[model samples]
Target: MVVYEGSEEQTNRIFRALADPTRRDIVRRTVSGEASVSELAAAYDMSFAAVQKHVAVLEAAGLVAKEQRGRERIVRGRPEVLRHVHAVLDELELLWRTRMQQLDDLFAQEAEADAATRPHDGTPPPPVP
Candidate 1:
């Protein structure tokens, strides 16, 4: 099987980080533009420490990065990580589509073989109730 750029562990971390609603929102917000840690904390009802934890998870997953500017820590989204995610999904879709086409071809072949084996009498088979 063809694997995407990241290792399995890294992919797992990325998915885990995105599993939380708060973390997902943080990513969406930061992707549009960078935000200060305090700003992100203020958006949520939770404590600043809770928001910090969310940012830590995102940073660990490589989905977001943090930079220090004076006394504030700025968080920015990494669009390239999202692109990697999309690439993996696209590959899986292609694999699934290929499998579905193979199944269709197999069923068609079976039907054709069944028809060939059937009698060529003028009368057709009774309808299935």
Candidate 2:
């Protein structure tokens, strides 16, 4: 397993927050531009309070920022946090790729060893030591 730069709790919160489809959509929308709580709620079929809860989850994950612009609660994506998330994902990818390469090398070594032991002609195989 790859150890990420952030704390385990924070990572868990981030993953848990993003696991929801509604929360993911909120992040995507806010990342592109700022949106008010009411505006976001209008786009979805759920009640405004439900959308607020989704936004709250994203906020707790540090994926988005919420600010009060008069009566409206403005929500915007945090690029820096997203960058950190991207880095974590990159690390995971690197770890998996490295593991895959190691597996490939092991397979190649096994194939070479098998080739060495097998008789080219129709003779019996070599006895194990």
Candidate 3:
């Protein structure tokens, strides 16, 4: 469970969590609406223990929360955790956009340099004939 100290490891954990299919499914299910352990487990072919482990990983990441009620555990996804993932992605997108713009500017500069270095005769550099 990361405490949001803003360390790189914690940042990577969010990415790692988003990488797993089962975890993503669990998040999608819970985010749309809450469900119980049995309900969630039944949706998958894997054993209950396997599903429980997935749920545990999600809970540890603070992506989901579990509550006990009469021996049934109800699970719900936390949107804020998903929002954190979105924020990281958004930041990365901004960085890439900035980098791409810089590359484009460099390309334009190179074109200008080529034009300046070329002769203005509007003719070939002299054919072999």
Candidate 4:
């Protein structure tokens, strides 16, 4: 299954944007509801312009969107992009699970081979402890 359906550049941008703690918080806030630039700025200790830059980064990554509402730029989270992120994570999890299963199968095969090679004299193996 193709996890990252988006372009490589887009995936990089999304990850880069999400790397920032403030931007992640912004995304979290916007996902619940839309907020104006000023409103978002007020929630943080940073300057308004700094918050604006974070929003811009998120917008560029397609994680969040901004629309002009009168003089204010209202920001809202893009759930579709987040869904893509989740899909990628799910794919990774599946890959790890498969790898673990393969390792288990290999260990089981090794154990079986070892048992088969053991002498049939009925002498039990030593205690593991």
| Model 2: CA > 4 A from native | 1-6, 122-129
Structural similarity to truth (TM-score) of each candidate: 0.82, 0.88, 0.87, 0.84
lDDT of 1 by residue, 53-92 (tens): 9999999999999999999999999999998877878888
All candidates in order of lDDT, best leading: 4, 1, 2, 3
Please give the clash total of every predicted structure, in order. Answer: 0, 0, 0, 0
For residues 1-129, could you state the per-residue lDDT of candidate 3 as single tens digits? 324556776667666777899989999999999999999999999999999999988887778999998999999999987887887778779999999999999999999997787779886554447
| Residue 93, model 1: Cα distance from true site in angstroms | 1.0
RMSD of each: 2.9, 2.8, 3.7, 3.3
State which candidate, 3 or 4, has the greater lDDT.
4
Top candidate when judged by TM-score against the true structure? 2
Which lDDT tens digits does candidate 4 get at residues 28-125?
99999999999999999999999999999999999999999999999999999999988877888999999999999999999999899777899886
Estimate, for each residue in 1-129, the C-alpha lDDT of model 2 and write its tens digit: 445566889888998998999999999999999999999999999999999999999999999999999999999998877777777889989999999999999999999999898999989887899
Screening candidate 1 with a backbone cut-off below 3 angstroms (N, C-alpha, C), the clashing residue pairs are none
Q: Which segments of model 3 are wrong by more than 4 Å?
A: 1-8, 125-129
